[model samples]
Target: MKKSLVILITILLSAVIYGCSSSSEAENADNNTEDKPTLTLGQTNWTSTIVPTQIVKQILEDMGYNVEVQDAELGAVYTGLSTADVDIFMDSWSPQQDQYMEEYSDSIERISASYEDAGAGMVVPEYMEDINDVGDLKGREDIVNNEILAISEADPAMEDLQDIIDAYDLDMEMVNSSEGAMLAAAEAKIEEQEPVVLYGWEPHSMFQQLDLKILTNEKVPEIYGDTSIHVTVQNGLQEKAPEAYNFLSNWSISIDDMTEMITKIDDGQNSEDVAQTWIENNQDEIDNMKSN
Candidate 1:
């Protein structure tokens, strides 16, 4: 009897100790997970960046991460990424933005291509049937005459674009305005079938909402060539948030997809609703990009 009682007591004690250890380990794990650092993202006024930024924010939150976004200027975004004030910047246009990148290349790193072939160029409503290319614009200047080429607020890339205009000695006026203002002007002009030329790029609401054509510029060199945009992150972001970085590195959306999103937003659909709709509809794309 004494022997049986001692064996039973020993087994009970061992089980209690084991259960405590397992419980302690689980508690520690929960605590460690709760301690993970929050991620910070930076966004500019560009819709191309804005839409993706929101998508990324949603994904990070789903991954149990704390994410914050700051609306900043182009220069400020680059500086923030370089200095690690921001963890990631979803909109970095290359070659055109080469000057800014070169200045901070040492501190900032290019994570991946967000959306390639995005940049500023002249675009006309599809109704302007004769103006098919950049060369054609010179002949039909009157139709597009006094029609200012709207541009986003002062950005270094805009400066490079202006240089191209000067080099080509193009007679059109480049109107300096906010992205919102430019879009509003473009919208009004398109509504009336009035001819206008404006700085345009992909992943924009205008592209989806309007039937337009991008005027081809032959004078632009091929190497510096086709315009493209990239996704850039702070120098230590990968090491800091490997999961978020991986999602961003693989994340990409087509001009058509972005255009549709922008169009929905412009047409009075709430941005959050539009974003949720996109996320739910494109689960496969998001899953492939976000998978380990």
Candidate 2:
């Protein structure tokens, strides 16, 4: 009876040990799904910037890659990529952001076109028929409150805008406010069908949510704005994480879809939730990139 009791105790102890080992292995496998090759995404603190960055971040996380996004001024984002502190940045608006890009040209590598021919520069209500050109605002300061609603003070574009204003000898003042402030001011003006112009960019929800038109940068098209909000990766990103690098290189989005997504996101929807929903609805697009 004593020997049988001892044998039973040994069997039960062995079973417990085996069960724990199996559980540990299962946990490790689950963790491995999200293990190494973590991606560091850098972004400027703007809705347009955040949307695509979060979208890609979520996509990578879904693909079992770890992602961490660090937000900073546009200049800092570029600096991060230059220093390899950031693995990738999806929206590098050229011509518009040429000044920032100029600094890291040698240290960074552009991997893909996040959005081809994306718009940027001053924007105004379509009803402002006379305001067809950026220079039109020069003499019409009274209607626009002598204030151009601009993004935060740190935006490198602010210098360009000042240059534009100075070049045109405009009597307008740029109100250095947050993006939300600018949008709110724009919304009120639009509601009253009043004239308002704010620093605008395409692939943003403003196009979908308002009857706005981009003020032509005829004054300095060559030096001002163009397109191709390209995806940029740290120089060694491809070598360090080929899967992520490939996915970003193959990624593409229609301007229409991006604008619509932005509109939804601006309507108080969570960005992650919106992006996940976008992925589900556009699985073909995402899947196609994956295979490529």
**Could you give the C-alpha RMSD of every candidate to the true structure, in order shown?**
4.1, 3.4
Worst 10 residues of 2 by lDDT: 218-227
Clashes of 1: 1
Per-model TM-score on C-alpha atoms: 0.83, 0.85
Q: By TM-score, who's the top model here?
A: 2
The number of the candidate with the highest lDDT is: 2
Question: How does model 1 fare in lDDT?
Answer: 0.77
Judge candidate 2 at residue 61 and give its lDDT. 87
Name the regions of candidate 1 deviating beyond 4 angstroms.
1-30, 139-142, 221-224
Off by over 4 Å in 2: 1-35
| Deviation in Å, model 1, residue 31 alpha carbon | 1.9
| Residue 167 shift from truth in candidate 2, angstroms | 3.1
Candidate 2 lDDT, tens digit per residue, 1-292?
A: 9999999999999999999999999999888874558889998767777778888998898778889999887888888999999889888876667776777878897778877777777889888998888777776788888888898877777778778878778888889888888899899989999888798888788876887888887767854555777888888988888788889999888888788878888889988888888888988889889789
Report lDDT (Cα) of residue 119, candidate 1: 42
Q: For model 1, what is the alpha-carbon lDDT of residue 75?
A: 85
